[model samples]
Structures are given as structure tokens and as C-alpha cells.
Target chain A: MAIIKRYRALIILSIILLGLSLISPERGTQALSLTSASLIDMFSLLPPILVLVGLIDQWVDKQVLIKFMGDDSKFLGVIIALLLGGLAAGPLYIAFPIAITLLKKGANIRYVVFFLGVWTTAKLPIVLFEVAAFGWKYTLIHVSVGLIFFYLVGVFFEKRFDPNTLLKEDITSNE
Target chain B: MSQSIFLYGLIAILTGLSWFKDRQKTKKALMKAKNILVKLAPELLAILLFVGLSLSILTPETISSLIGERSGVIGVFIASFIGTFAMLPSFVVFPLADTLVSNGAGLVQVSAFIATLVSVGFASLPMERRIFGKEFTYMRNLSAMLMAFIFSFIIWVVLPWL
Candidate 1:
């Protein structure tokens, strides 16, 4: 019963997919295949990424996280956040878990938000592809503008919300 | 695929080294990984299903028509809306955007699409909220959508010169 409750959303979605398949077989099959492909892509990336998160969680010292990305780190914190975010691959959802770990380990909210912003805008591989597809000037403008905007947004939220409260919510929900 | 291989190799090396340093700690890390994976499985499945369903409904041709040259402001709105809901791979997005541009979609609209595509994730919101709670999830996504619109406007203003 507990498992069913936990998976209620997924169960409903599967049922809807099944019903749609009955009405429109071709489109439904296409959707199924695409879903499977995405699942494969996700599985390929998630294990190692999650394992890395786990290792970081267990092995890395909280003091080190605070030293690098805490409120007092200032400009150095921003730089580290950008590097971590920019080097990362995979979708933004993947970043959420990692971000949670960072927050749990004493990283400041501002830098955590900055890290997410960079992940959204300036990942290295995606930047290369964007430049190729949209010209260097366009890519540069988009990335620079995006980075500045989101950094400001991050700072804005950092001022408005208490990071400890957010972290507390994360803990209670997980338990 | 290559990315996966690289990640696997890196994780293998790191895990081995971790085990060498402390077996118990290494086991704890793997156990943590297992817990997260199990917790996230249902949410992941739901996200994948939604992505697949959305993609099926919004075929490339359909998207091209919706954001064509004359689409203007409406096109930007549509593009941003679709982008928020859809989660295409980056490789697919760049090429698709290029195709749309060559086929007469406005640069502003495509820019909006790309911006929101990378930033916002309506489909992944459940997972995000699960991890970060409701307020953070909503704020992050709303800010991203604002950024997407701002980007679209900038591109519109700057594109004629470029």
C-alpha cells in the first residue's frame, strides 16, 4: 500500500498511456519508444552521477564545502559554483539532487542557486554545440546575459529566504 | 553513449580508490546511491512518460508551423510554452532550432524556445519539488521563464545587426 501510494502518479500516467494506445496505436507506440529511449539515456547517466553524489556526501567534509561555497567565500564561491555547474552534463533535474547534497553539506543558498543557473545556461558541451548552430556572437550574448540575470535572481532569493528552512523542508519530506 | 562510457570509467576508478581508502565508507556511499535511486524511480518514470507524450504531440513540423516567421509575439509565447513542457536533448534542440530558423521561424521565437528549453522544466517539476520543496521549485522555474522572455527580447533587438 505504501509503495502504491508513492507511485500513484506514475501508475496513473501509465494507465493513460495505455488508454491512448488503444485509441491511437501508432502515436502511442511512438511515445512508448521515445519514453524507453529517454529511460535508457537517463539510466546510462544517472548511476555514475548519483554514485558520485553519494561519494561526495560521505567523503567530502562539511567544513570544506563551507570554506569553498559558503556565505563568506564571496567571489571565490561564485567562481567555484560556475565551474561546477558549467562542467556538468545531463538535464537540470539531475542537478536538483546534487544541489540538495550541497545545501545539506553547508553550501550557501546564493552559490547553490548560482550553480543551478550556470548548469541551465553555460554547460561546456552545450555551449560548443550552441556556438556551432547559432554563431559565436549569438551564443556568447545569450550565455553572458543568462548568467548575469540568473546570478542576480539567485542573490535575490538568497536575501528573501532562509536557507536553513529550505534545508529543513528537504529533510522532513525525504524522511 | 560516449559520455556514459566516460562517466562509468571515472566512477569505476573513483570507487576503487575509495574502497582502497576505506571499505566501510565506500559501502555507505553505494548504499546512499541505492536509496536515492529507489526514491527517485517513480518520479523519473513519470517524467520520461510525459516527455515522450509531449514529443509525440509536438512533432517537428507542427512546431515549425507554430513558430514560423509571421508568428511574431504569438510565436514567442507558443515556443516558450512548448519549451517549458518539453525536455528534448540539447543535441536535438540545436539542430531542430537551426532547421526552424532556416525554414522561416523567427530568431526571437527560436531564442525563446531555446532559452526556456534549457532552463525551465515543467515536466520535471514534481521531481524538483520533491527534492527542494514547492516554493523553491516555483521560484526557480518562474525566474527561468522570465529569463527566457528577456532573452527573446534581447535577440529580437540585436538580431538585425547580426
Candidate 2:
């Protein structure tokens, strides 16, 4: 019962898939195949990321992390955050665990937010692809505008929300 | 893919180093990884299902029709909305954007679609909320959506000049 309650959303989604399959077999099977493909992708990507996170959590000293990304780190913190985010691969979802782990290790909220912003918009491989698809001028404008906007958003969010309060649920809830 | 190979290589090196330093600590780290994987499995399944369903319903034809060149600001909004739900990889998304542009979608509309598609993840909100809490999740997504709109507007104005 507890497990079912915890997985209520997935259970509901599965039922919906089943109903859709009953209603239209072709589309339903297609959806199922897509889901399985994504699942395999997730499996391939997530384990290594999780392992890295776990290893970082265990090995990296809190003092060292704080010195680099802590509240007073400021400009240097932002630069480091951008580099980490820009170099990353995979989707926005992949960034969440890494972001939380950084927070857990005393990284400033603003830097963490900046990291997410960069991950979403300015990742290196994605930027290269964007340039190829949209032309250099368009990609330049998009990347610069997105980076500036997200930096401001990061600062704004840091001021608005207390890090301790924002991370409360994550700290307590094991997931 | 190359990314997977790179990731696996990195993990293997790190794991070996960690194990060499302290067997007990490495064991603990692996346990932590297992715990996260177990906890996240269900939410991940839900997210994948949502993506599959949305993609099936929002075919390329439907999207192109909704955001074709003459749709203007309304098209940008529609594109942004659709983007929030669709979560294809960046590699796939760029090509899809190119196809949409060739198929009559405006540059501004496609810009909105690509921007929001990469930045916002409504389908993965549950997982995000679980990690960062509700306020952070909502705020990040809303800000990303606003940024997408602004990006499209910039493109709409500037594309004419260039």
C-alpha cells in the first residue's frame, strides 16, 4: 500500500496508457515503444551520473566545496558554475540531482541556479548544434540573451528564497 | 553513444580511485547511488510515459499547422506552450526545428519552440519538485517560459534586420 501510494502517479500513467491502447492500438503501441526507448536512454545515462554524484558526496570535503561555491565565493562561484553547466550533457532532468548535491555540499543558491540555467540553454554540444541549425548570428544572440537572462533570474531567486527553506523538503525527504 | 562511453569511462576511473582510497567509503557511495535509483524509478517512468503520450498526440503536422509563418505572436505562444510539454533531446530538437522552418514555421515561432523545449520541463515537474521543492520548481519553470517569450520577441525584431 505504501509503495503504491508513493508510485501513484506512475500507476495512473500506466492505466492511461492501457486505456489508450484499448482505444487505439497503433498509436498506443507507438507510445509504448517511445516510452521504452526513453527508458533505455535514461537507464544508460542516469547510472553513471548517480554514481558520480554519490562519489562526490562521499569524497569531496564540505569545506572545499564551500570555499569554491559558498555564499562569499561570488564571481568565482558563478564562473565555476557556468563551466560545470556548460560542459554538461543530457536533459534538464539530469541537472536536478547534480544541483541538489551541490546544494547539499554548501554551494550558494545563486550559483546552483546559474548552473541550471547554463545547463538548459548554453551546453557546449547543444550550442554547436544550435549554431549549425540556426546560423551563427542567431545562435550567438540566443546564447548571449539566455545566459544574461538566466544570470539575472538566478540572482533574483537567491534574494527571494532562503536556501535553507528552499531545500527543506529535499533535505528531509529521501529520494 | 560517445557521451555514454565518456560517462562510463569517467565513472569507472572515479570509482576505481575512490575504492583504492577507502573500500568502506566506496561501498557507502554505491549504496547511496542505489537508494537514489530506487526512489527515482517510479517518477522517471511517469515522466517517460507523459513524454510518449504528448509526442504521439502532437505530431509534426499538427505542430507545423499551429505555428506556421502567418500565426504571428499567437503562434509564438502556442509554440512555447507545446515546447513545455515536449522533451526531445537537443540533437533531435534542432533538426526538428529546421524541418518546421522549412515547412512554413516562422523563425520567431521556432525560436520560442526551441528555447522553451530545452529549458522548461513540465512533464518532469514532479521529479523536479521532489528534488528542489515546489517553489523552486515553479519559479524556475515560469522564469524559463518568460525567457522563451523574450527570446522569441528578440528574434522577431532582429531577424528582420539581419
- lDDT, candidate 2, B1-162, per-residue tens: 889889999999999999999999898888888877777777788889987887777787889989999999899999999999888866688888988898888889999999999889977887888778888899999999999999999998897798
The candidate maximizing DockQ is 2
Native RMSD of candidate 2 (Å): 1.7
**Clash-forming residue pairs, model 1:** none
lDDT tens digits by residue: candidate 2, A93-155: 988888988988999888999899999888999888888888999988898898899989988
Q: Residue-wise lDDT of candidate 1 within A1-175, one digit each (tens)?
A: 9888768778877897898899999989999999999989888888898899889988999999999998799998999989999988888888888998998888888899989999988999988888889899999889999899988998998897787777764421234
Query: What local lDDT score does residue B103 receive in model 1, on the 0 to 100 scale?
Result: 77
The regions of model 2 sitting more than 4 angstroms off are: A1-5, A170-175
Against the unseen true structure, what C-alpha lDDT does each candidate score?
0.87, 0.87
Q: What is residue B35's positional error in candidate 1, in angstroms?
A: 0.7
What DockQ class does candidate 2 belong to? medium
